[model samples]
Every structure is written in structure tokens, then in C-alpha cells.
Target: MTHPPSAHDAPWWRHAVIYQVYPRSFADATGDGVGDLPGITSRLPYLAGLGVDAVWISPFYRSPMADAGYDVADYRDVDPVFGTLEDADALLQRAHDLGIRVIVDLVPNHTSDEHAWFEQALAAAPGSAERERYVFRDGRGDGSEPPNNWKSIFGGIAWTRVIEPDGTPGQWYLHLFDSKQPDLNWRNPEVVEEFHDILRFWLDRGVDGFRVDVAHSLVKDAALPDWEARAVMAGADDEPVVHGDLGPMWDQEEVHEIYRGWREVLDSYNPEGDPQRDRILCAEAWLPTQERTMAYVRPDEMHQAFNFHYLQAPWRAADQQRIVETSLEAAEAVGAPTTWVLSNHDVVRHASRLGLPVGQPRPNGIAAGDPQPNAVLGLRRARAATAMMLALPGSAYLYNGEELGLPDHTALPAHVRADPAFHRTQGEETGRDGCRVPMPWVAGEPSFGFGAPDDVDTWLPQPLLYGSLSADRQEGVAGSTLELYRTLLRLRREHDLGVGGLEWLTALEGMPLPEGVVAFTNAREDGPVVTVLTNFGEVPVVLPEGREVLVASGRLHRDGDGRRTLHQDCTVWLG
Candidate 1:
């Protein structure tokens, strides 16, 4: 499964503008109140027009609806809620036709208890081959004692007992997530073989690649030691301990074998030798520095690991620039490509994260005790964020509805929320469902056509930005946010800044940024490149030097000092 040296020379993941879509909430072709593969196909052209190179559809595989679709019942089949295999095939064909690559979410860490493999493991006698499918051990002081001092990623003990038909206390199995999702025993030869075959199945079906869920969790600390690395258990707010890193043994000469072997499978699919016909492996590694993150992207491993520094970066202009510069320097130091994500299904929106108000909050999204965002300021800030996202180096991840300035609004009742970790932990840390709301394509209509075009009531009932911000309403508006996004994307494609080939120059400051302005440049091997200056302060600020002004949010004009001054909350590019 090897591609030609020339065709596979450059990594496709390097320059792509990737769009992440929660398929079930994207669009519903069957009017079944959920988005499906057919729905995705119908929307393919829209994504293509937006200029994204790849689409990462989150877990549409067969699942039990626990943790949304992360708990897989069958890795090979598309969940009926998301349509059948035929629908997926149609989507892949349509996207490829539009020149958009497709990548599906792969959760190899664990499978649903309902899966045949797990069920078999529960039924088998202790120490049997079937029992070995998962980490099944006796309770209490027996070999089971959880194998370590680990706590579940969801909170509480990581071990739970399984029962046989005869009421015997079957051995307990390890589950870093839900009690129903038993951890696969990577220590077992059979488990690794199972996943390798799963990889081949999709590659053969023509998927461009995969976003490996918990890529580092495929294997755990073989020693199964007690709590290590503090208590990273169950995310922030500190729950109990669970899951461990894939150690030297897991990174074992064997893990590389998995990726190298998988690459072979991907190249085999590109029989015609298309230059861009290849697989992309993205790992969700949120390491502190670029060097740590790049390890996942080097040659044979993940093509792109998650970059979280920007998301965690302070709103202060200098801080944000430093994060980007540090990351760029680190990647270059190791010669690895990076990926960028502004919003995802897990975190709060940029506007919310920045504490800005997001256009009058709906009564539904405002939790009983939460403060409502300053609606107007929120939208303005998000638009500005969009500008920054488009201009960044490497692949840009656009979550659904972000193009339309959509505000996060899923207001889950304390009881109905489904995220396992959120419930298991004490902060009642709102899990992802808050961000995976239905895409409101129609405005003001019943249920906003998110559920069914004809019905107003949807599983996720909130006002659809139809008349105000719906696709139908903003499709042709020249200056609408969606249009701005489209324009920005088109402009991004016209420059190598969106691509990965250019050298990125650090905006080293010899002096503090002039009161309200943030300035930086993208250096190119060909010549001096564009200098991007942005003003977020309350007053207009002037650059100390003069250059050709390319684009401006406020007025792009020269100052008395022969420098360019931009209005507050505006941007200017020197070409």
C-alpha cells in the first residue's frame, strides 16, 4: 500500500482547511429530526464553496447514543440515525466530486458493551481467550482490584463488575469512560489485529483518512500502576483517575508499525496515483508546547496533532501572538506540520470563552445560574475571531454554524444531559452536548427545520437564525457573516499562508505594541511578505511605518507620520 515518492511527497494534512461536522445535527434529509449521511451529501456543495479541503465527520458509526456516538456498537456500519452505508457512499462520492476530502472519526479506545466482542468477553470464563478480549478481573483484592489506583475518566472507580447468566459475579472489566464501554485489551494480540482490520475496511471504502479519538489511549500502562501524572482523571475540576498514556511499550516499535502499516493500506486505495489521494491521521494531542505536539506529526505517525495553545491563549494581543510564534518556531525546529482549531464540539465558543456577550442569549441557553453574554459584543468579537482563524498558518477547523456567527445555545436540563464525564464529575461540568446543537438552516420556522422542514418542534428546540442568520437568509447577502466567511476563505486559498509552504516570521517586539494595535508579518522565502496589523483597543492606533494597506476593517489610510492607522476593532494588511 505504498504511494509514489512524488505523489505522496508532501503531507496533505499540512495545508488543508478542515471542517468538523457533527453529522447528526448538521442536516436531516429524511426529516427524522437528525442529520444523516444523505443530509451531508445534500450539503456537500455548500462546504465545497466554503473552500474547506477536508471534512471530519464525528462518529457516525453504530452506537448506543451514549456519549453521543463515541460508544461504538459496530465500527463498520453507519448508525441508522445517520443513514446507511449507501448514504455514506453517496456522501463520499459527492464530496470527492466537489474536490473535498472526507475523514471519519475513529474510536479505537473502546467499544460498547452491546458490541458482540464485549458481550462475548462477559460470557467467557475467567482467564479464557474470550475473557482476554477486555481487561476482566475479579473484584476487591483479587487480580481485579482495578489493576491500579486509576480512577475512571468519567469519575469514581474505573472498574465495574459484569455478571453471567447464572448470577455469578463475572470478572470486572476496565472502562475509562462509561461502564458500558469496556476498554479493549491492547495487551492482547487479537485486539490490535481487530483495529487494523477496521482501518483497512474504511480505507478500502475510499475515506480520505481518520481523526483518531484518544489516539494515545489505544494502549495503557502495562504495569497498571496506581495514580500517575497527578489526577488528570475526568478532565478539569479533578475527578478520580482513569486511563494512562501509551508508554514506551505501547509506543512500542509496534505502534509505529500500526501507522506505517495503515499508510500502506491508504496508498493501496490510490491506484491511479493521484497526488493528493492519501490518508490524514490527526491526533487529539493537546500538549503544552509545539515540540511535544509535533512528535505525533513526524513522518510515520499522526499527520496533525491538536494545537490547544491558541484556544487557551489570553485575549491580549501580545499573548496570542506569542503563542502562535512559539508554536511555529517549535514545529520548524522539529520539521512537523501543525493543525489549528478555534471551536470544536467540546469547548465553549470563542466569544463565550472570551467572556463577551453573544447577541442576546435565548432563555433556553442561559442555565439557571449562568450570566447571559453581552449579545452584541459577542457577535462582533466572534467576527473578529473569524478573521484571525482564516489568516492563521496550517489547517483551520471550522465547526458547523460557525460561519454564520452562530452562538452556542444548547441548554441541557441537569437530568437529560448525556455526557458521561460531566455527570461523573462534580462541577457538573457541562459536557459537549452544549455545543452539539442542531444546525438551524431555516429561520423562525417551526423547530427551524432542524428537526423536520415541516415541523416547528425539534429534539433541540431553539430559535433557528433563519430570517436573521439562516443559510437561506444569508446565502446571497454580500456582507453577511457567511458571505464574509466565504470571501475570507476564498482569499485564504489565494495565499500560501493558508497553505503550508511559506516560512512564518515571528512578530518579535522591540517595543510594546502601540496602545491598541497588534502587528505581525508572514515571512516568505520568495521575498518580504505581508504584515498584518490589527487593532482591538478602544481607540484607533497608527503603525510606526508605512506600507501598502491591503484590507482594512476601519479605514485603511496613511497617517501624518507616514504610518498606517486603523480604526479600533479594525484590521489592515501591509503588502
Candidate 2:
């Protein structure tokens, strides 16, 4: 897709560079040991200067914090721990003033057990309208067994039996995630209409768009049949990538129907008179295939879906190339731009992931006694991988601290962990708290300047390594990851890489890339050509003649002929 001559001439989201902010760990302004809205607002200048086009803040709505704000109790109000409605309004105003858009997280699939609606459902008798708003069903045989044999993504059975107000055993409600997060019944008209109103409430508050949480989950199979015999998506090592159905719990066909209505709600805000002011929706879909993932971004539905396929790809040239090709092809067919992401709050940082031995199972949580990744190799590969990611022909998402080359706090004490994944699994599987440690803004300040100097403690302890890698220490330091990102983002926009067409180096007749190299050229119809190459092999590869180097992820070696040689785990942008 060709970019319009000016940002105002096209939808900003089409080629935007978004940054994901995990709030509780971003900054703490209230000195309460937790990151708050005012804290995020205070950091808007840092984001604006970072050159990102928008920020997708994780859920900060009123909640019991059972699942780190994912179990939203009130969709319209900000959690007191974070801030209030006035603080949210101020954040929106300040971010917009800085030319940065805001995309708030929306958890529509479930509501907290403490939510007013859920409380009402608990008090009302079974089969009442209040109970109908959720997936409350009578259990089979003495009402003791779960309604279905569905497993929660967290752990255990997906259904949770609730005790009635009269102290009698009642119906079981579907949770899909943590027990405290009751899944909403989308089939109920009140549930559907309530979300429609929730969308308008935020849109009217001036949010540019929403990052829909569990976009594929609002609707499930009507039958809710047992899934033990159904087909499941397997990993790359598995023989066939995808076959049969995705079971009754995920990627149901009815989800698209729900999103189409949301599109109408967003479109209502963007009349012909204000096309550039269009509101967009992004899906956090973790499907098994490009075909399934692309369905969420169809023209009349959501605008973009997370590319988990790319995020989960092994650090191999062939694998990366295949995913990029398929993703681009699939999105192009549906008139949507592909989204690229390397790190986020839910998984181990890509820096640490790349450092681990190839093909090892990704760890949910790492402690002191566990196998450790190679910090040096991990950061090197991470920088190279990021350069290649930013140069791809679409939007790129940067996690909060990946810019600082931050690795996971693998040795964090178990007692301080808060991720529901950890508690739900009873410590057998560590949770995502390793990667959610608070960012270090200063090298010497308490909590690394996360809050006031006297705020000695944070919600999650910072790793000792954060001292040297702090943003203050990295600033103005040449070759630092932070500086590399600033330069990469600047040139990406300057060359219009996001809106350019991508062609594999091998696709160009007579140009065969090295065996272990992934190379591509991106050029807009009216913009200069830019080439990105990454060396994943052990041997150095000689560069082609007469290409000017714009940026390099690491130091390059020069041969006798003065030609640049890209070393292993190195990436370079040539123009």
C-alpha cells in the first residue's frame, strides 16, 4: 500500500510505529510502589522523543488486580491504584498534543468476579436475566461436574462453580482464563449492547483506538462440545502445522460478526468530514495460521492483528523469511498491513529468548537455579533482529524496556511474583513477572527513578543488572541499543519503509543472497530504495558494491578491498 503524501491524508495506523506500555511497571508517580496514570503522563515526552507514532497502554481500568487489570471491574473508570477519570482525560490530551495517538486496552472477553454485573449474577437465581449476561449453565449430573471439559489457558478447568446467595450450590460459569475473570456471554443482547456502549464511552473520551484483548474469544462454539477429540494447532516441529478445527474454545466463526458491528461504531465517529481522524481497532489474536489471523483484519473488521507467528519464530534465516512472506501475502490479500513485534509483556524478552539454546521450550518464568541465557549474545541478536523488524514493510511494536536492551529478571524471588499464571499453576510454571519488572530511568535513584527518591520499593524488584543498562546511563552513549533505536526509527520514517513494497533479495533476478542471510529491499513508488540485510550465520558475508551504509547494528569489519563484511548476529541498513 502506498502511503499518502501527508499523515493527515491517510489513516495514521496504516503505517504507525506503536509502543506497548505495561503500566504497573512503567513509572510510579504516587510513590505508592505502583505505576499510575500520572506517572505515564509524566513520561509522554520520553515517548514522543522516542519517535513512536502511538502507545498501546495495557489495561488500567478499575479492577481487583486479580489478573493485572485484565479482569476489569469497571470499563469506564480508571483504577484508583492507577489514577482517576480526570487523570485519564489529562493523559489523552497531553499525548495528542505531542502528535502521538493513544490506544487503550479493552478486555471484552471477561469481567472480574468483583464486577457489579457479576455480583448481580451471583445474587440472582439461575436462568435470570442477570445470570444470562454471563455463561452461567447448569452442570451435568448432580450439578457438581463442570459444564464442559474445557481447560483454562491459565490452568485447571475453564468452568468455575459459583455458590448461590442462598448458600446452595448453583451453576458453573466459564472463565477461560483465571477463575476470578468470568467470561461474558456474547450471545446475550444485553452483553453485546453493553460493550457497544463501552466502545462509544472511550471513543467519546478521545482515544484514537483500542487494542482488543482476546478478540477471538468473545464468541465460542454454540455447542460448547468436549474438545478432547478435536484437532489442535501444533508447533513447527510437529508434522502438519494446522489441521481440523481449533476446538470449541477458540477462533470461532461468530467472532467476525461481532467485530463488524464494532467497525460501524468506530466509523460513526469518522464521518466523511473527518476521515483522517478515523478510529481503529487492533486484535490481540494468537491463532495458529496466517489464514486464521488474517480473518480478524478483513476490510470491514479490525485493522490489525498481532503477528504471533513471527514473534514465536525461531532465530533462523529460513524461518524468518517464510513467516514474513506468508504474513505479507496474507495481509495484502485482505487489504491490511502486516504488524511486526519482537517483544511484549506476556513473554520472555526477545533479547533473552534469542540467547537461549535454539529449539528449547520457552520458559514461563526463570529463577536463580534455572538455565541462564547468554546476555552478550542475546542483546547482540536482539539489536540485529530489531533493525530487521523495523525495516519491514509495515508497523512495528516495541515493548517498554526492549529499547534499553533489557533482559528478563530471571532470578526474581518467587514471593514477590504477582502474575496470575504463576499463582494459578501453583509455582510449577513460573509466570510473566520476569519481563514486567519496573524500568530503570536512572542509575542511582531508588527504584531507578520509578518514583520519588524515598519510594525505596517497587511492585516488582528491579534486577541488579538494571543499574548499568539504565536509560540515564545509555543516553548519549554511542552504539547503545537506545541510540540505535532512535536512529533506526528516524531513518525508517525518512525512507518511508513502513509504506514501501518489500522484495526478497533472491526474488530480484541475478541477485542471490548468502546461504544464512535474510535480505530484502523496500522502496516506495516515489521514495529512495533502502536495503536491509541480517547475517545469522557464523561466517561473515561481503557486501555488494557501491551501497552507502545508513546504520549498522554492530561494528562491521572492513576487508583489504574496503568492502564492509557483516559479522554473525549483525544487521545493516544500506541505501
Candidate 3:
């Protein structure tokens, strides 16, 4: 028998399956061809049906859309393009009524250059109090070059030289990302106070939590330093190695202090109140190691941090096992639960990323000139990988459209690309537009039913083949990726797999398994033991004798000797 979720016992967030909703691409209810708060509110019933415990909405704040909503122009208001403040309240209320919590993005590291404070700083004289809210420093040479040699994550120099009101060259401002996004000076008390107020604004309106964007990047090293050669050449043009000694820009020690303060603010919401209603905070931190990642989720700090290392691990049994072990160990040390994620709006979709060679660094975007991804192989592996992730003893995050097994649209026309990386790299790096295409909802409809009316044009064009992968096409279809996800979620909750203890099972009794297979058992105190087996090799492996099969990612073959066989890139849950 399955027990109802009780937060007073373990809290909803500890083992919740949170679905990430990229507001622009999730669903467009208005005829405007853009997703809005009302659009998301209308879809709460769907998410509730999907069995997700919460919804983590991406940034929908007022912005210039320079970095696709990461550059915030205003913190307290919703973007007019997405919807108004009233719509946000409605989304929150509807989600709560459906027993799903809501977590909105909180981007504190930077703000859009068009923001009132940024505009005032530009008009004010150098070294003025207005400029102190942001990182402003004098150039190294004749004040023409940048102060330091730091490079922006997008491309080009991290510093942008500012022209004085008197028409003379002045100090430069720092922007870790697009130039339009000026990095805030976290050292400033006013900046800290402003974010605190912003957090309360949403918390007061009944938001469940905040997904802190670039959580590790809030505090920079006091002394700016140049990037070392090894660090500069770490990844592709668009992929910056923010992990491992990225000096003066990311993973600074002071960032922990900031989150500790934010933790106090979150705790204030549930003072002597029900633990079930306690507001939570999750970090989008990209630390170097699992141990380092756990620092953000210490008992007194944030509740969870994204497991990027697990997502980037190669599709090998050993690699996956090592990451899982380290992640669980580190999270356990802090008394916090681990968060497993496959894909998000920023990176190439997992379907395409998994199809590439195992060890090579994956690019953020794939261009038309690039080699094509093997969609069939990618989808098979993705389905198996997600099954394994959901059975693990922690929370799992599902990006929008992953349930439909959507691959990145690599053939997108160059003219429609909007990612700043594409513009900065001059098309050398296609950017992340391929993964951010509007999600398909209905088959054989214009824009694939991403928006209302056949004539409405989505913000980003949908691929011609999207109709086949539409949610409408996959719904209720056996063996479909969507159905597989729904089944796995149902089983996960029924067996308490999300909060159960995990034990690696290499061989049953005396039977030895294949070399490239991963097997583990999700053993709950009271529920039946669910053994998960995944095959990464070419040849099919025989399933252990006498074990009853519960579910499988692909078709299974039965041997005459009464043994069940699992095909390559397939996963199964057995009792």
C-alpha cells in the first residue's frame, strides 16, 4: 500500500519530483504565440496528473530578453511579454490547489543594463555611489583596455568600458555573461538588502521557494585576476569552465555567506510554523566536485543543489556508478537530499547530448554543419538513464519535453537564432536555440499546437517533425517515452523509491552479469525491494532467474530455459 505524502514527516522537497517549466516554451494560452502566467496556470492539472510534487518555473521576470530572461530589468514584476503580477498570483494559487508547489527563479548575480539602477549608474559620474552597486574598476593601461583579463561566459572580454557623461573614456563594468547583464557588486550592503526585499516580495505572495540562478557566482574574489591558460582553454568557445579554480568570477568562498543569509530569510517564513509549509531554497550551483556542491546544501543553508556532474557524466556503467556514489555520499554528509537533472534550457537536450561520443566535451549548441545526432540511439539511452535516475534515493528534475523524448532541433535556421552566444561567436557556436524551441503539444497543427490559432507564430520556430513527438501524439500510447515516464513516476511513489536506500547489486546469488550492466536495488523499510538493471552493451543479458519483471524500457525476450533477456540500452524494474 502507498502512503500519502507528509511533509511534517519528511518534507515535500526532500524526495519531490520537480518538473522544470521554461515559461516561454511550455504552453501558450493567449493568441500572442508566447507562453504566459495564464498559460502555465491552465497546465497545472496536466502537471498534477504527471505526478510531479512541484513545478520549478524558469525566469519570467521583466527583462530585455538579451540573455533570454536571465538579465532581469525588474525583480518584483513579471515581464509584460509573459504576463502581469496578477497572473503570477493566479498561477501560484492554482498550483497549490493541485497539491503542487511552485518555485520561481531568483537571479541575483546580475541585472539587465536597462534596469533603473544600471541606467542611473551609466548617467552618473565614475566612482559615484550609483556605480558602487555594480562592479566598476579602472582599466589597467591608459584606461582603454579592461581592468582584468577575465572572459565572459558567452564570449569576449568580461569588462565593458564605459564612456563618461563628458564624452571621455572611463572605468569598465563587469559582466560575467552578456554585456547587457551587469554583474552586481555583492560586496555592497545595498545590493544584499535589495535581494532580501525581492525574496520577501515573492514569498509574501505564497511562492514555495526560489531557484537561485548562478548561486555559486554571487561573490567574486576580492582581487581580480587573469585567467590561467589551462582554465581559458578548458572547453569550447561557448562553454566556459566555471568549475575548478575559475578565479575572481565563480565558486568563491564568500558565496556561502550570502546563501546563509538567504537561508535566514527563508527560515523566517516558517518560524514555529508547520514544517510542511516551510519555504525551500535550491541552488543552481556548478561547483567542481560533488563534495563542493554539497556545501551549498548544508543543513543551515539551502536545501538542494543541481547535480551537473551527474548530468555531464559519460554514458558508461563505471562513470555513472562513481558519480552516483559520490553524490549520495556528499549529500548525506550535509543531511540533504541530492537532486538529479538530465537537461535544462541552457544546455543541449540530453537526447542529443547522449548520442555523441562518450568522453568528448559536449557543445552547448549544434549547427547545421555539425555531424547529425543519432536520434534512435539517443532516445533509447535517455529512456534508460531517466529510469535509473528516478529510482535513485533523491529528487529528480524533468525538463519540459523530455517526457516526449524531444531531441534538439539542430537544423534551426540561422536567422531565427536568439542566444547571445550565437551573436557573440558570430555563428561559430550556434548557441542553445536548438534546445529552447517551443514545445509541441498537438499533432498536425501549425506551430505544433505550441500556441493558439494556426496562424500564430511561436517565439521560436518548431521543427517540422515536432508533430510526431507532440504530447497529443504520445499520450496513452504504450511504449511511448511519455507513457514510460508516467509509469516510472507512479512506481517511484508507490515503492517510496525516491526516499529509499540504494544498494548496488552486481550479481544475484551466484549468477554473474555482463560487464557493462548496472544493477541496483531501491530497498524501502516497508515496501518491496525493486531491483533496477540497465544494459549499456550491445548484446542482450539474461535477467536473473525467479525475479518478477515490473516494468521495462524496451521489449524483453524470454529464453526457452525460463530466463528473461534485456536488450542494449534498456532498463527494467524487477521485484
Candidate 4:
């Protein structure tokens, strides 16, 4: 059967190259050593020049910052650390003027305990309207024990007992993350109505779309059954437990109904005659299978869902190829473009993660006492992997510092680390602070020129190695990671590769390729066909005959017969 058209046939986000800006680290315009909305506005021209079609700003909402702004206190205003509502408006307008769409992060799974509703819940008696908005339960036995055996994703009991204002022990509330962030009761109609209004609030301010955080976690089973430990639920030491039957806490079937309601809100914003103005929703669901993930991107639900399976796949040709095929097929079935992401704010940077032992668990963070990463080998593989991602058939996402080939500061001092996971795991996990360090802009400048004043200290300390990877140092330099990105993005637009269909060249007749290599062609009906190949093995491989070279990750060697040879861990583009 033929695929159906997506929500908007020619929407820009369908095949867009989106750049994610983790606001706290992007730029420090306020001189407070924290990046803000104004700072991001100042850099729109740079993003436009980088050839990205859109920007997804991480949460800048008014927050206590207990979980680095993911624990939002007020959904309508910006945090003091990120600037005011006017600043956010100016940034959105500036981005639109530059032909770049803006997508803001929407955290719907929970709210900061300081939120008015949560505060009211604390003051009100149990079974009151305020308490009904959250998941409040009575403790079993002596009212001191937790209601169930549920463990927090952050490494403790999910339930926290609250003391009544009368100075007696009280009912317990649930927080899947940190205690400061309480899970919302999606079963409450008021919670549903509130978020619906929140959507309209942002869309009215000219936001093109939203990136829904924890999209698979809004709903829970009504019965709140006990979690049964299964082998599939036992994840690796470093990775989060994302798969398996996580009872009542994740991946409930009722979550889709909520997205369908959200889709209606997004559809209402489309002007009668302009499909280009349609607002979109992208889900950050970490489901077990691609088929389940695609369910979030169906026509009446979200516009897209991130393909984490592909991102978490090992750096092997066979594994990568299988994930690509599965992801494409799943998206095609629902008529949604696949979204490929390599790194983001939550995980360790892929550059360093790929350098670790192949079969071992990729840790969320590495401590000073742990084995260090091989920077040289990691950067090379990261560059090659980026080239391959850009040549694929769907939209691609670039994290803030990936263009500079930045490796995680794996040896960050334990005392200075801010990620909640670090404290929750008692420094054993190291947390995601390494990946969230501020971006480097200038060499030899204090804080690497992240702030306006050279002497300003960043919230997170920058390593000495950042000097060599600063954007100012890499700009205009041949073969620099920054230059490579600019070149690839420019080529992608000029050749229409982002909107083209993909075909595996290795499956074609008379194709010459070695094992542990991936080869594919981006084909357009009226444009030139582009071939992309990557060598993941130790040995070199001969390139296809008579193809014009477009670009390559590294220098290509020529044999006596004029055949081009791709070296190990290299990718090349040809037409």
C-alpha cells in the first residue's frame, strides 16, 4: 500500500535540519554565566548561516532549576536565569525573520513542587481538590512505609511522605524523578485542561512547534499495580531502564489520547490557506520498539517522535543498517518522516560514548576515577558518523556543540557537578553535567568567550582542551569540524538530499563494497543521485568506479588504476 501524506504536505519541519540549544550553555548574554533567550537571539544569524531550518530551545520557563529547569514552576513566563517573556518573544520573532522556525521544550509529565498547584496541594487536606490534582496516596502499615515497591528513575523510592500542617504524619505523594518534581495526575481533567491552555499560550506567541519532554509518561494505569521485575527491565549499569513492562509509570496506552487532544490544538493554529504555518509536536518517547514509537507520529497524534533506537545502536555497520531500515519502514507505514538524532542535553555526548568499549554499557557520565575516553579516536568516528547521518533520508538534529566536535568533560569534579542524578546516585553516576558544559566560542578567552566579559565564570567550568575546539578557532579552517558541518549542510540543501528518497547501493547489481561498510544513494526524481559510503572496518575499500567525488570525511587514497580508496572510519559522498 502507498503511504499517506503527513499532516502538512510541504511543511518545513518535515525535512528540516534542527539544531538544539541547551539555553544554559549556549551563550551568556546577561553576564551571569548562564545562557538566556536574548543570548540565543544574538546567535540566530549563526544558526541561519549553519543552514539549519529550525531551532529547538531547551526549557527556559520559570523554574526552581532543581533539575536544571526541567522542574518548571510556572509555564507562562521565562526563568530569571534565562530572561523575561519579552526576551522570549524577541527571540521567536528574530528566528522567524531569519527563516528559522522555533520549537520550545514542553515538560508535561511533572511540575516543580514550588508550583502554585503543588503548593496548594501541600496546604490542603487529603481528598481536597488541590490534592486530587496530584498522585497522593496513604502509606501502608504504620503510615511510614511507601505505598509500593516502586523505585525512582533517579535512584530512590518514588513515594515521599509529607507532614500535615497540624504536625502529624500525612499521606505520601509520587515523584518519578527528584522529590522537588512531582508527577502530575493526568487522570484529572483539570490537568488536561491546564496543559491544553498552555499549548495555546505558546502558539499564540508565534512558536512554530513544541518538543514534548517525557512524552510516553503522561498517563498511568488506574489500578496502580505493583511493578513486576522482569529480565527485560534489567538494563545495563550505565543506561537508564527504558524498555520492558514498566507498570503504571510508563508507556500507558492512554497517553495517545492526550496527544490526539494536543494534535487538535496544533491543527487549530493552521491558517485556512497556509499549510506552512501549521504547528507541530515532536514526542521524546523512549519506547521499546520502533513500531510503538511510530504510533506517536500517526496522522492524528504528534508530527514526529525521536528514534532513540537508532541513536543507541552500536557503532557497527550491520547494527546501524538494521536500525535505519526499521526506522524508515516504521515511519513510512505512518507517513511521517523519520527523525534521526545523535546527541542531546540528557545523554553523554556521542563523541566520547562511541570511544568506550563496543559492547559495554555507555554510561550517562564518567567520573575522574573511571577510565578516560580516547579523544582522537572518538572525534574521528563522530565526524564520520555525522556525515552518514546528514546523507540519510530524513530530518537530522544537531546538539549545540557537536559542530565543534566537543567531547564530554568526563573528568568533571564531583563537587561542581549539578545534574540531579549525580546527587541522587551519590556521585557514583557522575550525571549528565559533562555534556551540558557551556559552549566554547573563542580561544584564550576566559570561559572560552561564552559570556560577554572575558573574566566571567561559567556555571560549569570549561576544560583547558576547550581552547583548541573553540568555534572562533575552527571557523574558516579547512577540514575543521565547524567547516565540515557548514559544507555538509550547504550541500544537503543544494542537492535536495534532505527531502530525497534513500536506496541501498549494496543491494544493487554489480555494486562493489566490502563487509562492515554501508552504502546508500539519495535519489530524487529530477535531481542528481548522491551516493554515501562509510568504512567501519580496519581495511580500506575501493570506491565505485566513475563517480564524481563530492566530499569526504578524510583524505581519499588513489590506487594505480585511479580507483579511490576510503580509509578506516571514513565516509565519502559522491554523485
lDDT of 2 by residue, 1-575 (tens): 22222232346677789999999989889998899999999999998888999999999999999999999999999999999999999999999999999999999999999999999999999999999999988998999999888877676788999889989888999998899999999989898889999999999999999999978888888888986632222222212323535567778888888999999999999878365587999998877788888999998999999898898888989888888988888888888888999889888999898999976766666777789999999999999999999998778899999999999999988799998867777876687899999999998888888884563578888888998898999888999999999999999989888877777785322556668899888877677888888999886878877778999999999888987789999999999
Clashes of each: 9, 0, 0, 0
Model 1 spans with C-alpha error above 4 angstroms: 1-11, 142-147, 228-257, 267-275, 356-366, 425-427, 451-456, 463-467, 500-516, 523-528, 543-570
Sliding window of 10 residues with minimal summed lDDT for model 2 = 230-239
Our tally of clashes for model 4 stands at 0
Of models 2 and 3, which has the larger lDDT? 2
Q: Measure candidate 2: CA RMSD.
A: 2.7
User: Considering every candidate listed, which one attains the maximal lDDT?
Assistant: 2
Q: Using lDDT as the measure, what is the rank order of every candidate, best first?
A: 2, 3, 4, 1
Which regions of candidate 4 are displaced past 4 Å?
1-9, 228-243, 452-455, 507-511, 560-562
Put down candidate 1 lDDT per residue, 275-322, tens digits, no spaces.
576677887754434665676666656667777766666656666666
Span of ten consecutive residues with least summed lDDT in model 1: 1-10
lDDT of 3 by residue, 1-575 (tens): 12222232577788899999999988887878788788889888988888899999999999999988999999999999899999999999899999999999999989999999999999998889999999999998788888888877777788999888899889899998899999999999999899999999999999999999988888888888777532232224334555455566777888888888898999999998676887999998776678878999998899999999888888998898888888888887788888899999888899888888777777878887898888888888899999989988888999999999999999988888899988986887678889988888889777777775777778888887788999899989999989999999999988888878788877855678788888888866766889899898876788877788878988888777867899888899998
Q: Residues 1-575, candidate 4: write the lDDT tens digits.
A: 11222332456777789999999999988898899888899989989988999999999999999999999999999999999999999999999999999999999989999999999999999999999999999988988888877777777778899989798999999888889999999989999999999999999999999999989888877776677442122223444453455456778888999999999998989858365787989999877778888999999999888888877888999998888888888998898889898899887788898787776776778878888888888888889999999988678899999999999998788778898878987876677899999999989777888884666678888888988999999989999999999999999888877678787766323755778898888866677878888899876878767778888887899887887789888899998
Per-residue lDDT of 304 in model 3: 91
After aligning candidate 1 to the native by TM-score, how far in Å is the CA of 413 from where it should be? 2.8
